[model samples]
Target chain A: MISKVGRHSIRLVSELGELAGFSGKASVALPGQRHIMEKLTRSIFEIGVRCVPITLIVGLFTGLVLGLQLYYVLTKFSSESLLGQAVALSIILEIGPVFTAIMIVGQAGSALSAEIGIQRNAEQIDALHTMQINPIGFLVSPRLWAAIIAFPILTTFFDLIGIYGGYLTGVELLGVDPGAYWNRIYEAVSVQNIVNGLLKALVFGIVTTMICAFQGYYTHLKSDIPGARGVSQTTTRAVVYSSIAILMFDYLITSFQMAS
Target chain B: MSEATTLKLRGLKKAFGEQVVLGGIDMDIPLGSHTTVIGKSGTGKSVLLKCISGLMAPDAGSIAAGDEKGAPPCSYMFQQNALFDSMTVEENVALPLREKGKAKATEIKKRVSDLLEQLDLTAARKKYPAEISGGMKKRVALARALITNPEIILFDEPTTGLDPQRKYSVFDMIRSYRKRFGFTVIMVSHDVPEVFEISDKIAWLDAGEIKYWGTPDDLLANPPEDLKPFLNPQLSPA
Candidate 1:
C-alpha cells in the first residue's frame, strides 16, 4: 500500500513538473508567435463569445436561489434587509468566478481538450514538430491568452446578472423594499472585493486552461490506452482535474486574501 | 558519406523500455532516390523514420545528412495524413511556411497556389480534410508536404487504408512528384509488390535490424531466407 502510494506521488510530481514547463514554454512563445492577434481573436471567440449565454443563465439562477434562501434565513433573525449584502458578497467572492469557470469548462474547455487530444492521436502534433514548428505555440498559447483576458470579463458579467437576479427575488418576490436591497449592496461591495473576485477569476482561468491544454497535449504519453480511448481518457481527466484545481485554488486564494 | 548520398544512418538504435526497436540500423540513402523500408507490424520501420525525421531521438548511433551542414530540411507525411481537420486545404498546406514566418505573404500565397494547382487540389483548397475524399486528402497531404520544397520527405504508411486503386494512385503520385521535385524519399510501407514499383531500393527490416537492402529486382530474385515468407506468403510451406 505504501509503495503504491509512493508510486502515485512520484507520478503526480512528475506530471506537475511537466505541466509547469509546458505552461512556461507556451507563455514565453506568445509574444513571438506568428499572427498572434488573429489566433488570439479566434480563441476569444471560442472561449468568450460562445460561452456568454450559459454564463448569464447560470449566474441569474444562482442569484435567485441565493436570494430566496438567504431571505428566509434573514427573516428568522429579523435581518431581511441584509439580503442584498449577503447575495452580493456571495456572488462576487465565490459563485461568480467558480460557476463561470465550471460553465466554461463544460462548454469550451472540454472541446479544446478533445480537439487537441484528437490532434495528438492523429500525429498532427508530430507533424508540426517535423516542420520546425512549436506545437505548444501554435496550439496552446492563444487559448491561454484568451482565458486570461476573458475570464475576468465573464465573471464581471456573471456578478452583475446575479446581483440583478437577487434583486428580482429579494425585492420583487419577497416584498422587501427595493431601495434597501440596492442600498445595502451598494454600501457592502467595496472596490477591494471586486478586485479580489476578478483576481480569483484570472487565477482560475490560467489554472483551468493550463490543465485542460496539458492533458490534451500529452494525451498519448499520459494515457494508458491508445487512440480514441486515450483521447477520451485524457479529456475526461482534464475536466475533472480542472474542476478540482478550481476549488483548491479557491480555498488557497480565499485563505490568503482573508489573512492579508 | 559520399556526395551521392542524402542520408547516412550508422548503428541507429531505439527502444521502448525493454523492447528494443531498431537494434542498430545502418544504411546510406542516395540523393534523389526513393527508398522504401518494408517490414511486418511492430518492426520499428516507423521508429527508424521518426528518428531520421527528428520526431524521436535515437538511443544510440548517428543519423547524418550527406552534406556536413547538419540535418537537411525534411517533411513528414503521416499515415493518417495528419491534416489539420479545422484548417482548410489552403491553410493546412501553407501552415509550415506561415509558422516559419520567413516568407512574405505574397511568396507564401504564390507557393501554396502553385503547389495546390500542381497537385490538382485547387478545387478542394477551401475544403476541410473531412470534406474531401480519401484520394483528395492524400493529394492535399502531398501538397502540404511539398509546399515547403524540402530536400527530403518521409512517408509513413502513405497508403495504409486505401483500396488497391487508390494505393496504386498514391504510389504514382509519389513517383511523379519525386521526379518533378527531385527530393529524396524515405517511405515505410506494408504494401509489398506495389511499393517495389516506385522504390529505387528496398530495405527489409526484421527483429530491429535491416535484414536486406538492395534493388527491387535483387530482393525479388534472391530475397533473404527469413524475408521470403514475408514477401511471398503463398510460396512458403504451410
Candidate 2:
C-alpha cells in the first residue's frame, strides 16, 4: 500500500498533468471568428457587464478608506501631500487587479463551474462528443478568452473609479491642496504601472477561469463525490481554488517583477 | 441474413479494476435492423453500447464497422435524453448540423423545423428542455440523433423512466421513423415485451457474455437454463 503522503503526491501530480494538457489543448482549439464573437458577447454580458455596479461601488469605498488612512499616517511625518501618490500607487499596482479578479472568480467562475457540472451530470457533454464537437472548444475556450478580454477592461474601470474616490477624500474632504494631489498622482503613476496592473488582471483571469473549467470538467471523474452532491461541492471548490490561485499568482508575478 | 452486418463485435472485453463488466462479448448488428440488448443491471449493457459507439474503448477485442476505410457517422440517444437545458427544442435538434458545418444556417433551420414537425414537437420548438415533459424530451433527443442522418443509432434505454402510455408512444415513434430512415438500431432496454415488439433480434447478456442471441420467438421457445428463470419467473419455486 502507498503511504498517505505518496498517495497525495500522486494525486497532485495527476492534477498538474491534467491542467497542463487542458491548457495546451484549449490554446489550439480556436473557434471561428463568428463563433468567438457570439460566445464572447454572451460571456462579457454575464461576466463583465453584470459585475460593473458592484465593482464600481467597491472601488470607490476602498479608495476612500485608503486615502483617509494614508492621510493620518503621512501627517505624522509631515508628508500629507503624498496622499494621492500612496492611494494611486496601491490601486494601480495591487488593489485594482486583485479586487477585480476576486470578484470575477466569485461571480463568473462559480457559475461556469456549476453550469458545466450540470451539463456533465445531464450527459450533455457526452452528447457533444458523440456529435463530433470538441467539448472543450465549445464549452471552455470561449469563457477563458472572454475572461481575458473582460478582466483588463474591468480593471481599468476599477482604477479610474478608485482614483476619483481617492481624489474626493484627499482634495475635497481632507483639505489637501488639489494642485498638490493632482501633481503627485500624475508624477507617481506611469504607463508602465497601468500596463503592469493590466498584465496582472490578464494572468489572474486566465488562471482562475482555467482552474474553474478544469474542476468542472473533472467533476464526474472524482470518485469520492457523485451526483448533485458532487456538483455543489465542486462549485464551491472551484470558487475557493480560483480565489487562492489568484492571490498566489499575484504574489508570484509581483515577486518576479520585483526581483527583475 | 438479408441485412449486412453493419457492426461486428468480437472478443470485446472491459473491466474496472478486479470487477469485470464485459468479459468477452461477440455479436453482430445487421444493417437496417432493430436489435435490442437485454441484461440485468450492472451487466454492462450500457458499457457494451459505449464501446460500440466509440465512447469507451474495450480493454481487449475488436469492433469492426462495415466501412473499413472510414467511420460512418453514428449517434447515441442517452438514457437521460441529454438535451441541453439552455437551448430550445429546435436548437437542440439543430446542434449536430451546426457542429458539423455541413449546411448553411437557413438550411439547418429548415431541417430542424421539418424534424420538429415530424416528431410532433413543433409546439415545443421554442421551449427549453426543462419546460418539456419526459416523453417530449425523448422525442427531442430522437430528432437530434436523426438530424445527422447517421448510419447507426444507439439508444440507451430511451424509454426507461416513463409511464406505460408514454413508453408505448416512444416505441411507436421509433418504429415509424425506422421505417422511413432504415438506419441500424441497437438499443439497451429493460422493457421485455414492448421492446420485443419493435426488435427484429434480441441479445441477452449474462455473466459478462452474450448468453443468447436470436429472434424474440426463438428466445421464448428455447431459452438457456440460466435465462429460464429470468424469462419466466412464475415457474420457479418462489
Candidate 3:
C-alpha cells in the first residue's frame, strides 16, 4: 500500500514538472508573433468581450449586497458614513479581482480547456508536432498572453460597475447621504489600491489560464483511456484546478498588498 | 524515382511500463519504394512508423538515416488525418512549409496552391477540416506530408475509416506521389489487397518484430506459416 502511494506521488510530481516545463516554453515568444494575431483576437473576444455582461452582473450584485449589509452594521455604531470607504475598499481591493477571475474561470477558462482537450483527442496537437511546430508556442501562448491582457482591464470594468452599484444601493435605496458616499469613496481609494487590484487580476489571469492550458495540453498524458469521456474529465479537472489557483493566488496577493 | 534513400532500423524496441510493444525490430526501408507495414491492431505498426518519423523515440534502437548530425528527414500523415479544425484546408497543407520558415510568403502560397490543385482539393481550399469530407481531409493531410519533400514519408493507416472509393483514391494518390516525387513511402494499413497492389514490398509485424519482409508475390507464393493467417485470413478460417 505504501509502495502504491509512493508510485502515485512520484507520478504526480513528474507530471507537475512536465507542466512547469511546458508553461515555461509557452511564456517565450514564438518566431511568428505576427501570425498569432488571429489567435490573440479570438482569445480576447472569448475572455473579454463575451465575459463582460456576466462580470457586470456579478460585480453589481456583489456591491449591492455589500452596501446593504455594511449600511445596517455601520448604522448600529452610528458611523454609517464609513459605508463608502468600506464599499470602495472591498470592491477595489478584493471583490473586483477575485470575482472577475472566478467568472472568467467559469466562462473562458473552461472553454479553453475543453477546446484544447478536444484538439488533443483529435490528434491535432500531434499533427502540430509532426509539422515541427511547437504546440506550446503556437497553441498555448496566444491564449495565455490574451488572458494576461484582458483580466486587469476586465477587473477595472468590474470595479467601476461595482462602485456604481454600491451608490445605487447606498444613496438611492438605503437613504445614505450621496455626498458622504461619493466623497469617502474618492478620498479613501487611491491609485495604489486600484493598481494593487489590477496586479492581482493580472497574476490570477496568467496562473488560471496556464493551469487550464497545461491540463488541456497534457490530457492524453493524464489518462489511460481514449475518448470523449477522458477529454471531458480532463476539462472538468482543468476548471476546478484553475479556480483553486485563482483563489489561492488571491490570498497571496492580498498578503503582499497588506505588507506593502 | 530518386535514388532510394535507405532507412535502417536496428534493434528497435519500445515499451509502455511493463508491456513491450516493439521488441528489437530490425528492418531496411529502400528509398523511393512504397512499403506497407501490416499487423494486427495494437501490434505497434503505428508505433514503428512514429519511431521512424522521430515522433516517438524507441526505448532501445537506432533509426539511421543519411544525416549524421541532424534528425532523419521524414514527414508523417497520421491515422486520424490530424488536420487543424481552426484553419482552412489550404492552411493545414501549408503548415509545414510555414513552420520551416525557409520559403518566402509568395513561394509558400504558390507551392500550397500547386499541391492543392494536384490533390483536387482546390475547391475545398477555403473550407475548414470540419466542413470537408473525410476523404478530402486525408488528401489534405497527404498534401501536408508531401509538402516538406522529405527523403521519406510515413503514413499511419491512411484509409482506416474511409469508404471503399475513398480508400482506393488514397492508395492511388500514394502511388502517383511516390512516382512523381520519388520519395520513399512507408505506410501502415489494414486494407491488405489495395495496399499490397501499390507496395513494392510488404513488411508483416507480429509479436513486436518484422516476421516477414518481401514482395507481395513472394509473400503469397511461399508465405511464412505464421504470416499465412494474416496474408489469407478467409482461407485460414475456412
Candidate 4:
C-alpha cells in the first residue's frame, strides 16, 4: 500500500512537470507563430463568442438565486439595502470568473482537446513535424492567446449581467430602495476588487487551457488505450482536469489575495 | 557514400522496451531512385522509414544525407493519408508552404493550384478531407509532401486500405511524380509483385535486419532461403 501510494505521488508530480513544460513551450512559440492574428480570431470566436449564451444564462440564474436568498437573510437583520453590495461582490469576486471558466471548459476546452486528440491519433501531428512545422506553434499557441484575451471579457459580461439580475430581484421585485442598493454597490466595489477578480479569470484561463491542450497533445503517450477510445478518454480527462484546476487555482489565488 | 547516393543509414537500431525492432539496418538510397522496403507485418518497416524521416530517432545509429549539407529536407506520406480534416483540400495542400512562410500568398496559391491541377484534385479543392475519396486524400497528401520540393520523400504503406486498381494508380502517380521532380523515394509497402513494378531497388527487412537488398528481378531470380517463405507463402513449413 505504501509503495503504491508513493508510485502514484511520483506519477502526479511527473505529470504536473510535463504540463508545465508543455505550457512553457507553447508560450515560447507564440512570438514566431505564423498567421497568428487570423488563428487567434478564430480561437476567440470558438472559446468566447460561442460561449456567450450559456455564460449569460448561468450568470443570470446565479444572481437571481443569490438575490432571493440574501434578501430574506438581510431582512432578518434589517439590512435589506445591503443586497447590492452582497450580489456585486459575490459575482465580481468569485461566481463570475469561476462559472465563466467552467462553462468555457465544457464547450471550448472539450472541443479543443478532442480536436487535438483526433489529430494526434490520425498522425496529422507527425505529418506537420515531418513538414518542418512546429505542431504546438501551429496548433496551440493561438488558443492560449485567445484564452488570455477572452476570459476577462467573458467574466466582465457575466458580472454585469449578474448584477442586473440582482437589481431586478432586489429592487424591482423585493422592495429595497433602488438608490440605496446602487449606492451600496458603488461604495463597496473598489478598483482593487475588480482587478483581483480579473486576475483570477486570467490565471484560470491560462491554467485550464494549458491543461486541456496538454492532455490532448500527449494522449497517445499518456493513455493506456489507443485510437478513438484513447481520444475519448483523454478528452474526458481534459475537461475534468481543467475544471478541477479552475477550482483549485481559485482557492489558491483567493487565499493568497486574502493573506496579502 | 557516393555522390549518387541521397541517403545512407548505418547500423540503424531501435527497440521498444525489450522487443527489438530494427536491429542494425545499413543501406544506401540512390538519388532520384525509387526504393521500397518490404517486410512482414511486425518487422518494423514503418519504424525504419520513420527513423530515416526523423520522425522517430534511432536508439543507436546515424542517418546521413549524401550531400555536403548536414541534413536534407524530407517529407513523409503517412499510412492513413493524414490530411487535416478541418482544412479544405487546397488549404491542406498549401499548409506546409504557408507554415514555412517563405512564399507570398500569391505564390503559395499558384503552387497549390498547379499541384492540385496536376494531381486531378482541382475539383475537390474546396472539399474537406472527410468529403473526398481515399484516393483523392492520398493525392492531396502527396501534393502536400511534394509542395516543398523535398530532397527525399518517405512513404509509409501509402496503399494500405485500397483496391488493387486504386493501389496501382497511386503507384503510377508516385512513379510519374518521382520522374518529374527528381526526388529520391523511400517507401514501405507490402503489395508484393505490384510494388516491385515501380521500385528500382527492394530491401527485404526481417528478424530486425535487412536480409535482402537488390533489384526486384535479382530478388526474384535468387530469393534468399528465409525470404522465399514470405515471397511464396505456400513454401512455408506448415
State TM-scores per candidate. Answer: 0.97, 0.95, 0.94, 0.97
What TM-scores result for chain A when each predicted structure is judged separately against the true chain A?
A: 0.99, 0.95, 0.93, 0.98
Question: Per-residue lDDT tens digits of candidate 1, residues B27-61?
Answer: 98887899999989999999998998889999998
For model 1, what TM-score does chain A reach? 0.99
RMSD of each: 1.9, 2.4, 2.3, 2.0
Which candidate should be chosen as best, given DockQ against the real structure?
1
Clashing pairs in 4: none
Kindly list the per-residue Cα lDDT of model 2 for residues A102-177, writing each as its tens digit: 9888888999998998899989898888988888888888888888889999998999899888888888999999
Scored by TM against the true chain B, the candidates give 0.95, 0.93, 0.92, 0.94
Where does model 3 sit among the CAPRI classes?
Answer: medium
For model 2, residues B1-238, the per-residue Cα lDDT tens digits are 2223567788999999999999988887777889999988899999998888888888998877654522356899999999998889988999888877759999999999998888899999999998988888998999999998888889999888789899999888888899988788899998876787899999999889999999988877777888876677633444
In candidate 3, residue B132 scores what lDDT? 87
State what share of the real interface contacts each candidate retains.
Answer: 0.90, 0.67, 0.60, 0.87
Single out the weakest 10-residue window by summed lDDT for candidate 3 chain B: B64-73
Query: What root-mean-square deviation over C-alphas does model 2 reach?
Result: 2.4
Candidate 3 lDDT, B1-238, residue by residue in tens:
2333677788999999999999998887777788999888999999998888777888988877555422357788887888888889988888888766678889999999998998899999999998988878888888988888777888889888788898898898889878888778899988876787899999999989899999988987898888766768734533
Q: How well does model 1 score by local distance difference test?
A: 0.92
Could you report the DockQ of all the candidates, in the order they appear?
0.88, 0.62, 0.59, 0.88
lDDT of 4 by residue, B180-208 (tens): 88888999998887888899999999989
Model 3 segments beyond 4 Å from truth?
A1-12, A29-34, B1-4, B67-71, B234-238
Which numbered prediction scores highest in lDDT against the true structure?
Answer: 1
lDDT accuracy of residue B215 in candidate 1: 99
**How would you encode candidate 1's per-residue C-alpha lDDT over A1-260 as one tens digit per residue?**
99999999999999899999999998888887889999999999999999999999999999999999999999999999999999999999999999999999988899999899999999999999998888999899999999999999999999999999999999999998999999999999999999999999999999999999999998988899999999899989999999999999999999999999
C-alpha lDDT score of every prediction, in listed order:
0.92, 0.86, 0.85, 0.91
User: Looking at candidate 1, what is the lDDT of residue B32?
Assistant: 85
